[model samples]
Target: MASAIKRSRTSFLTALSLGLLSFGISSCNGAWRQRIGIEKQPVAEPLPEVSDGPRSAPLKPGDNVIVEAVDRVGPAVVRIDTLKRVASPLGNLFGGRAPIQKQAGQGSGFITRSDGLIFTNAHVVEGADQVSVTLPDGRSFSGRVLGGDPLTDVAVVRVVADKLPVAPLGNSNDLKPGEWAIAIGNPLGLNNTVTAGIISAVDRTNAVGEGQRVPYIQTDAAVNPGNSGGPLINASGQVIGINTAIRQAPGAGLSFAIPINLAKRIAQQIISTGQASHPFIGVRLQSLTPQLAKEINATIDLCKVPELNGVLVIEVVENSPAAEAGIKPCDLIRDVNGTEVKDPSQVQLAVDRGRVGEAMPIVVERDGERLTLNVTPEELPRQQ
Candidate 1:
């Protein structure tokens, strides 16, 4: 009986071990199938498309500012076309009688008054037999050159139109570097082209040429050919300068504009007197270089100072403001209206800021003594 009982227990133990082994093999096979990706994964349902209606993203603050400025100032910008006569080179080769050639040129301008008064660079309409002004609205009219100042390169034109859009003039003296600048003009024959940039510099003295009297505003704006005479506007859409000349070199990124304050003064003079005249102190002045100072010190013995830092009066015009104010040749100009000046251009700029018949205080070093003299400037005589 004991043997039979023992045999039954052994059989049960063996059966239980086989059952566990079978279960382990089934689990391993299942895991292997999953690891090899033989087992299929449940498919995910497709999501519905999101809809937000037809509205687009709002413009950024900078974009809004630019758009506002353009809308405000675009209508005042005008296209200027000039017709002039030129002598053909081929005709000159044929005979002494050269054939007359007609040439058309284009530039930009802005309306300054509602009665059709326009402002532009003097060179734009210089020697133009016929000037045609086209408004932004595509309306065209004949324009008459009222006046032009070549030194400042400012001109005025009058069109026979009423209720014209005019650009407001801004104070250029308030301009600062890094301020926003917008240029609206016709660049390279493209009408009403707009360019945006920042004011790179202010109070730039010499840009166009040595004779340019007005201080220039320098910018990185892309001013190309045919952009001359257009308005350089501020963020407020007011004209701060007039686009004049651009430096055309690879990677130069230099462009210049005439300050609107100076241009406005010139334009007002042209409208009132048919021409612009700058105030002068009637002295031939030259910058005091080291070599020039040495020459003057050797010859005149008046500028033998330790360090000369001012313009030297080379010649005082006879019976002029300088002579009348006791300023003589060899006198070193130290200051104008209490502003220290180092170059003759500074004196010119000071005189330009003053009105005719206005007394200007000039400080000079005469014979090792500082002398202050009051001189009333007169209008510069027009060239004969």
Candidate 2:
């Protein structure tokens, strides 16, 4: 969600339904895609024909896209096992278990580089005392965590092996909602599990967590525990997204994946610098519709909103980039970097893409006057 992506400015007022995987990853379940209930799943919709963009080809009636995609990328998927030291109260008392017992966790990941570099979720290797990476060919290696960006839930783990199988990363920006989505992972300790569905949505953002900034891809593909950090490939047999977490709606639990576009950017940084930087210009935003604008004007007396549909700047964080740029409360954000932003998510996406210390120009309307402001984004505070 935008709330989790690079200090994304908040727009929604309601609580998000997503259960972020950074906390209490149960051993029975893995990390990211635990199943609350599967028998109660909603009926699947009819499958629509999809194009693979540049790789689009005519599909024969007997052509199995899932099998084809798996054959191409399955060898690169790996099972990750973590051993964390946990403090136990029954520290060898009365023949009980010893103190600081070893807690094990299971999750999935894929090799993104030929030089033993692996891509996985931050939660998977966050507190692990030791990480064991097992390949499909029965090869295991002790993994070293290069770094992890918890705000984005992206991490990079490297092994000493050479010439690893690399899964091809696709352009997530080219993914359409109706395109075929194939998930390959180790779910519920089932290694090399494959699931097929369609891409339900893309650019899925909202309040997921306080500091997590992930443009999640929504899919009907089943993701259970131990599926975290696995690749959600496209029909072209390319990694379009990384199966991250699930958000439970009414009767169904919607599986979500982090877009490869965002994941690759964060992953590259982790590979190079062992840490990631998230640019932030702190400002609380709320998308305003015509009816919402009328209500705000009628009730809110602090500042009257302009008669336009755009993102309304609610609160400019103190000493933030928005404050340094003289952005004020009740300002209607109209444009950023020559692009008109109608929703808070768009603004968040723009700000997230901006490089740290770069001067980003913004246009906001206050009292019907359009004022252009130059905001120099800074690294988000690490505490959050």
Candidate 3:
């Protein structure tokens, strides 16, 4: 009986050792596969050398012309910093994570008037419990939220400072594609960082499905996260537009600026009523495509009415100016008040320049016939 028991115990020991050896072999195979064939790490490229010395680009004589623009506008540009306690997710032993508190955010701005009136994007200072502005002269001041226009993403703030530098407004209508555009602002907390680029495009109302009526000028300038509300200036040192948006991602050479003419319009309204008076026409217009133009008038290749004309109306808002003036959806509007509308923007521009209760004549083509409709413009209610 004892001999039999000893034999059984030896057999069990032999099986255990074999099992352990098999496990070790399997583990070694996995490690070898990882090291030899399966795993390949990406090669890291060397970073670009950043010089510690004063990095200055070789300037041409024409570049010196911008010196005055920089010097004159530099003082008005202000730095904006914000702090807010935000909830952060913390590691947890259980499946549920704990909430941790953290402070976050960044931005820029500029003084618009001497009595502390400031200009900036609504998003920059929105929800900021405490707002502060720092001048180039190292003078810090408290900012008051005068009002904000979310449609245009423009906001006004006032700082109680004496003798503030106000930037002179310029006509954005004069800006052309390829014109020099200088942007001066605090980007990424680097105060007074100036970037230069050209006017890539104009009247670019590239709306991202947003229902707002504000049009934006698109540029290829290297505007980044913190450039909102900065000025896009021309060579004459006039602000052509307000820097507002960039591409949804980093690399797309697309940046958008609110037209300075539009900004001036909003700013004037805000300064007067603490809000913007957005102009509206009660008609939805669609560009007259060739096919549609042919459908409306078989003979007229280019629909030109006697009074005012250009875009073909698709719909008139209920009780809107066009509707009240008996304007139909199929009517092709070729002119407004004496200005002939060549495009949708030109129509908008004419309507935008006109005030509520002002009467203007719009020429249209209906069934190969030309007719004039008198429209008494109405104030489009301020969007909430």
Candidate 4:
């Protein structure tokens, strides 16, 4: 009876041990499967919930805005492909117009008025023997030079079109720095290309032309060779300026445009009067800097006689308006009309706004003596 009881106990112990071993094996396998992500159930963490918030604004692009403008004004914009036959000096000396060599150049223009009056840069069609405009619609028209003002680098060309889309004109006086700007033209002969940027600056006066100084609107819009005469439009698609010049260097995005205000005035005069008159003060001026005052044997007090910041007359044209008004060398011009002159540039700008045959008040300091002279403004000759 004792032997049988012992046997039963041994059998129970063996069964219990087997059951424990089976549980241990199962736990080890489960852990391995979970670590390796091989279980029927997911072993990885759940993803975080996403919120429905607005996305951030994108960075402003330099080329895309201009491209957009080009798209908007596509039909109105035209390519001026011109063939200029230069009279070869040798051919001119040898007589017979040597088989005219075709020289091609590209420029851009926008239809300003509904009558098909296109405005472009003067340099584009300066001496072209034949000028033709190509539209985005694949239509072509013979263009005639209505008028050109080289001083302002603006020109008017006429084309025959039944109906035309005109670009909206913007007031340049209202253009401010940091506003959006776009340039559209046939840059590098690529028709209807647009370049975008901001008005990096405004009223820039570093431009030199025909031995004269011009205040220009500076922008960073990537203007290239073919962009000359193209429209620089604001966000509202209004023409703000006419793209004219660009610095020819990589990363040198310094480009200039003729203010639409000035261009519009010149264009109107060109279309109606056949010529535009630019006001000019018949005198060469040197800014009244300390060094300049010293060089001219003038004192700061005497230099201040003009009641302006800049130096006065360096040379006055004989019998010219300045001389006629008793303005002489060493005479400090303090003001024009009623505007105070800050520098030669400001004086020139003020003079440019005046019309020919108008009388402008000139306040000058001569030998430390203040004098008010009523100078009769004269129409500068077209040649000047």
lDDT of 4 at 239: 79
Q: Order candidates by lDDT, high to low.
A: 2, 1, 4, 3
Compared with the true structure, all predictions reach lDDT values of: 0.76, 0.77, 0.66, 0.70
What value of lDDT does candidate 4 attain over all alpha carbons?
0.70
Model 4, span 1-384: residue lDDT tens: 000111111111110000000125786798889888897654654422111112223234556554554555656778999989765656645576574566888999988766678889999998888899988788899999988888788898888875677676777997789998888889999998877889988877655442333568888888999999988888756678989998665757688999988888788788776667776557766566554444434432323233335645656666667766677666777887788876666677777777676677878788777888767667666664
Candidate 2: give its CA RMSD in angstroms.
Answer: 15.3
TM-score of each: 0.77, 0.81, 0.70, 0.76
Task: Give lDDT tens digits, candidate 2, residues 17-82.
Answer: 110011233634542234566234346554221112234243333567678778778998999999
Model 4: per-residue Cα lDDT at residue 180:
83
Segments of candidate 2 deviating more than 4 angstroms: 1-62, 89-97, 207-212, 249-252
Leading candidate by TM-score? 2
TM-score (C-alpha, index-matched) for candidate 1: 0.77
lDDT of 3 by residue, 1-384 (tens): 000111111111110000000125866677777788785544655422111112223234564757866776778888876565555555563757556444555677777666677778888877666678888889998777777788778887777876787666667886788988889887777888888888888877544332334567777777888888888776666667788888765546587888877776677666667776555657666555555444445444333323333465655566566766777655677777778876665677666666666567777778677787777776666544
Backbone clashes (count) for model 2: 6
Q: lDDT of model 2 at residue 314? A: 67
Q: What is the alpha-carbon lDDT for the whole of candidate 2?
A: 0.77
Clashing pairs in 2: 4-212, 4-213, 5-212, 5-213, 33-224, 33-225
> Worst lDDT window (10 residues) for model 4?
12-21
Ranking by TM-score: 2, 1, 4, 3
